[model samples]
Target: MRINQFISHNTSHSRREADELIKQGLVKINAKIAQFSDRVKQEDRVFIKDKRIHKKTQFSVIVYHKQKGELVSHKDDRGRKTIYENLPKKFSSWLSIGRLDFASEGLILLTDSALIASALMKSDLEREYYLKIKGHINKEVVEAMENGLEIKNEKKGAHSKSKISSMMIAPFLEYEIFGSSGGYTKLRVVINEGQNRELRRFFGHFDLKIMDLKRVAFGIVELDMLRAGKYRYLEKTEYEKLRDFLRINAIKF
Candidate 1:
């Protein structure tokens, strides 16, 4: 494999991230600093920073509290704001595991290893989101969403359904869902799917307006007391827990 490809597959660093590592003189091959275009043979020793490459410690994960209007990608063609700009200078060579639309704000996971990112992004990984919608959400609508609905494109001959797992519903605190144009309304929703704009699409189907959406939890990683726009290093235990989760859940074909 090529050096860049090797880094991408073994760690959460994207192709671009691997290139940056090469430029920064952090990646080594066969006891020598490796270039981005260098080819990696099976026996070539790879080192990231000062540590020898090891599958157990190869990836680092972080949960970022994204703000509205920030693009999830590292760079945007339209010069729009990006989450990368908000990260500290040392938070380098990481890529988002999944995306949060510019209009949404919530927990976003980023990683330095591509393999770990791929594992967590798989469909079986259960993610949790909390949404505040305008007005009362009819119980029937909730059931419809839980049961899965035919999305817009699937409205034709063969309808398709996007299912939510482990849904929990209750009334949200009146003040919790503030900042909407409409009057205070009681709404509480929890969903397991992290599909793009999924909560908004579900509300749109019922003609209900969504005021705010936040992803509160991802697997075992929860927002906890981490303030918005702040991030911390993922401890070794956290990474091991995630790896164990994947090990137990990975599907075999």
Candidate 2:
């Protein structure tokens, strides 16, 4: 594998972070400063900051059913409850794959293997969510959403010229209206890309307020009957299924 990939797979750093470390001359291969294009052999020795790197063997993957009002992060300045607090003490070293916002609740994956987390996040794996929205559910609204909508980029600075962009919603891939009742609509949404609050922003264009959002599935893993504020170690079959889904041959860590 490439040096960056090797570093990222063997260490806690992500691929991007590994590139930064190489650029800073902190990484070495077989006692020589490594280049970005360098490849690793099974027998090759890798070091970071002059310390020999040893691959971690015991890796844990957890599927957490996050509850609303809990932060995905480990700490909060305001002393709000966080998902980490709900986890066992042994999982303090694990990292969440992505984040669920303070108000959002659902399946969030946590893993001790950074390589697995990074690979899954970078892949085109689908994340399924069940959204409860306050709106008059109609064919028009569903069609509009399926056809895509222009939503302002929340991250763009005030002075940015192009603030609006089309949020692509593939009818067969990203959206499907499952049920609706009494001005409350439930929809199943599948998104491959991890856009920042894309669902909330998408509905905002139609003035449809999301009353509740729950992620029911991610990639090959389903929330199933996993209770809120609870977590369970991923089964061996589940872990292998995820690896197969990502088309990853092996996990070094």
Candidate 3:
């Protein structure tokens, strides 16, 4: 890994902070000052201010059942509840695979390794959800789900501060409608990629409001019997599957 990444992952410093420290001549590799372009192997010894840095090689993953109303962040300036606040203190430094918006909740994966998180987040893994929305899911929505949709300069469902003006929503991997009742419709949907406020934007274009959204599965990891606000370590089988996936995808560390 690059020296900055090494410091950031093994220490509390961010990459930018690591860069600043390197510039200050505090970071060392094998008793020599590390350059900005330096890379280290497993045998290399890295230190910051003479304190040895230990990079954990053993992989660890946690599966958390994210409850609604909790932000998927470390600390929110708005003082809203954050996932880290509820997670075990040991996992405070772990990285979430992706994000579940504050209003949406369900399965979440956290890992201690940034490389693993980055690989899974960018992969075209399936994300499945059950959702309820205002009004019936009409033919147009079904067609769009199957054939994909294109929006230009329409930011209806996106976050207010989002700078995205144009987005191309890919076709859904699968979708199941359970019919509408009492001004609401329930459906199960699947998509491979996580776009910015994707489903919300898609339905918002049709003037429909999503009343509830919950993810049930991500890739091979399922929410299963885990209750809201509960969490568990990934099963051995689950970890093996994840390892096989990364290996098959030829993801390099």
Expressed as tens digits, the lDDT of each residue in 100-119 for candidate 2 is 78889999999877677777
Candidate 1 CA-lDDT value: 0.67
The C-alpha RMSD of each candidate to the native structure, in angstroms, is: 7.8, 4.7, 1.9
Compared with the true structure, all predictions reach lDDT values of: 0.67, 0.78, 0.89
Supply candidate 1's per-residue lDDT for 252.
17
Q: Give the per-residue lDDT of model 3 (tens digit) for 1-253.
A: 8999887667767677899999999999998999999999879999999899998656888989999899989899999999999988988888899898889989999987877888889999999999999999878988999999998999888888999978899999999999889999999999999887898998888888888999999999999999999899999999889989988999754
Prediction-by-prediction clash tally: 6, 0, 0
Q: Give the TM-score of candidate 2.
A: 0.75
Give TM-scores for every candidate, taking all chains together and pairing residue i with residue i.
0.68, 0.75, 0.92
How many steric overlaps does candidate 3 have? Answer: 0
Q: Rank the candidates by lDDT, best first.
A: 3, 2, 1
Candidate 3 segments whose C-alpha is farther than 4 A from its true place: 11-17, 41-44, 52-55
lDDT of 2 at 109: 95
lDDT of 1 by residue, 93-181 (tens): 67677887777777888877666666677644556666666666566675665566655432121113434332222222112332333
* Runs off by more than 4 Å, candidate 2: 1-29, 32-43, 48-51, 56-59, 152-179, 248-253
